[model samples]
Target: MTPLECVELQLAAYNERNLKLFLTAFAENVRCYRLPDMVLTIDGKAALGEFYAANRFVHEGLHAKLLNRMVVGNKVIDHELIHGLGPEPMETSVVFVIEDGLIAQVFFIPAKSPS
Candidate 1:
């Protein structure tokens, strides 16, 4: 699949809460971090699977809307409206770096509140 297609498949798997399908879009040694700080929050497909297994179905009404998308080289950046991680929907941006047609790294950056 193309990089954008890879990200789309993962997002579909996520909404479906299908852990196995979700894992298919990622590399074995995938890394995920928060933007700005870039602190590694998840490492490897196994760890990511565990995280989703525990949290993916935590709440109902879980869905995401891609507000915008941009693809450059092997990277796919998405601005999204995410719901069900909490009580309210959040506007966030995620960057997916694809390598060999699998997501190698993901950076999730939630919109910051005004200071």
Candidate 2:
């Protein structure tokens, strides 16, 4: 699958809370990182699964609507808005690295709001 398609699948899986789909879209030893917290790495599907289970409740019905996507080889960067149950909607940038049709790594950054 193309990088964009892989990212779309990943986002869909996350929105739907489908652990199988989420796991399938990622490599066996995938590493996910969150911005401002470089040392936090979720390695392997089982560890990712545990993390998802713990935080999934906060994201019920959460979905990402991509506003822009830039692709450079196996990497895709997405500017998106996340809609879900929260005080306010969120905007973020997601960087995905795809290898052999599976996501090898993902990085997230909180989008700055207009002042």
Candidate 3:
């Protein structure tokens, strides 16, 4: 699958809260990092699945609304507004790096509150 296709598939799975289908877009050794500092947050597909299943998919109202998307080569950058994690919606930017038809790495940019 192409990079954008893989990303879109994952987004669909995420919104559906389907852990099995969500994992299909990722590589076995996928790594997830928090950007700015590039701190590693999730390592490997198993951990990714576990984290989302236990921490995320359980939220019945959980959904990420895509605000914008930009594809550059093998990277897909998405601007999203996420709901159900808290009382208020959260916005974040996620960068997905695809390799071998699967997502290999992801970097998340947390939203900054306006001063």
Candidate 4:
């Protein structure tokens, strides 16, 4: 799938709380980072799957709306409005690195103070 297609599929999987589809969009040894710091948040597909199980679908209304998206070569940068993952909706940015049709790395930035 194209990078955009992969991101779209991942978004669907997140809203549906479908672990399998979520995993399919990523490479086996994917890495996730928190931006501004680039701190490692998740490493490996199995670990990421566990993370989704614990956090992705805590509420029935969990969903994301794409505010903006841009593709630069193999990277897909998405600015989104996220709901239900927390007490209030949040605006977050996600950068996806596509490698061989699967996401190999991700950088996540939350709209909160990084302290």
Candidate 5:
């Protein structure tokens, strides 16, 4: 799949809370970081699955609305409005780096602070 396709598929899987499907778009050694400070948040596919299963997928109301999307080289950048994690919606920008058609690294930038 293309980088944009991988990202879109994962976004769908995430909003549907489908842990297995969500993980397919990622590489085994995937790394996730919070932007600005580039703090490592999730490392590897196992940890990624665990983080979603334990912290995110459980929320029945969890959903993300894609506000905008841009593609450059092997990267897909998405601006999204997220819900179900808290009382108010959260706006964030996520940068996905694809390698060999799988997401290898991700950087998340929250509108307010680190997430």
Candidate 6:
């Protein structure tokens, strides 16, 4: 699959809350970095499952809409707005590195817009 297709699949899995599909889109050893602190280096399917379970609560009913996407080779940067999880919607920028058709790493940075 093309890099763009891989990204699209990942987003679809996330939106549907299909954990198995979501995990399938990731590499065995995936590195996830949440800007400003959180970092998780997960290995194997079991570890990925654990990570998903731990974050499942935070993702309950959360929907993310991609505003823009820029792809350079295997790396994609997405700008999105997320809804349904908090008082005010949150905007975020995410960088995804796809390797061999699977997501190898992801970096998320939160943003605040002036009201």
Across residues 32-71, which tens digit of lDDT does each residue of candidate 5 receive? 9998898999999999999999999999999999999999
Instruction: List per-prediction Cα lDDT, in the order shown.
Output: 0.91, 0.81, 0.97, 0.90, 0.96, 0.80
Residue-level lDDT tens digits of model 2 in 1-115: 9888898888888888788787788888888887866655688878888888776635776776779999999999999988774667789888899999989888877776334
Candidate 6 lDDT (Cα, whole model)? Answer: 0.80
Listing every candidate in turn, what is its Cα RMSD in Å to the true structure after a full C-alpha superposition? Answer: 1.8, 3.0, 1.8, 1.1, 1.2, 3.4
**Alpha carbon lDDT of residue 18, candidate 2?**
85
| Candidate 1, 62-98: lDDT as tens digits | 7888899999999999999988887778899999999
lDDT of 3 by residue, 1-115 (tens): 9999999999999999999999999999999999788899999999999999999999999999999999999999999999999999999999999999999999999898334
Tens-place lDDT digits, model 4, residues 29-91: 999999898799999999999888887766788889889999998899999999987798889
Q: Worst lDDT window (10 residues) for model 5?
A: 106-115
Candidate 4 residue runs with Cα over 4 Å from true position: none
Which candidate has the highest TM-score of all?
Answer: 5
Candidate 5 segments whose C-alpha is farther than 4 A from its true place? none
TM-score of 1: 0.93
Q: Write the per-residue lDDT of candidate 6 for residues 16-105, one digit (tens) a residue.
A: 778888788888877877775666656565777786667643577777799999999999899998776687778999888898998888
For candidate 1, the lDDT comes to 0.91
TM-scores of the candidates are 0.93, 0.82, 0.97, 0.94, 0.97, 0.81
Task: After the best TM-score superposition of candidate 6, give how far the Cα of residue 57 lies from its true spot, in angstroms.
Answer: 6.2
Candidate 1: C-alpha RMSD after superposition? 1.8
For each candidate, how many residue pairs have backbone atoms clashing (under 3 Å)? Answer: 0, 0, 0, 0, 0, 0
Query: How many clashing pairs in candidate 2?
Result: 0
TM-score order of candidates, top first: 5, 3, 4, 1, 2, 6
> Which is the better candidate, 5 or 6, if ranked by lDDT?
5
| Cα lDDT, model 5, residue 3 | 91
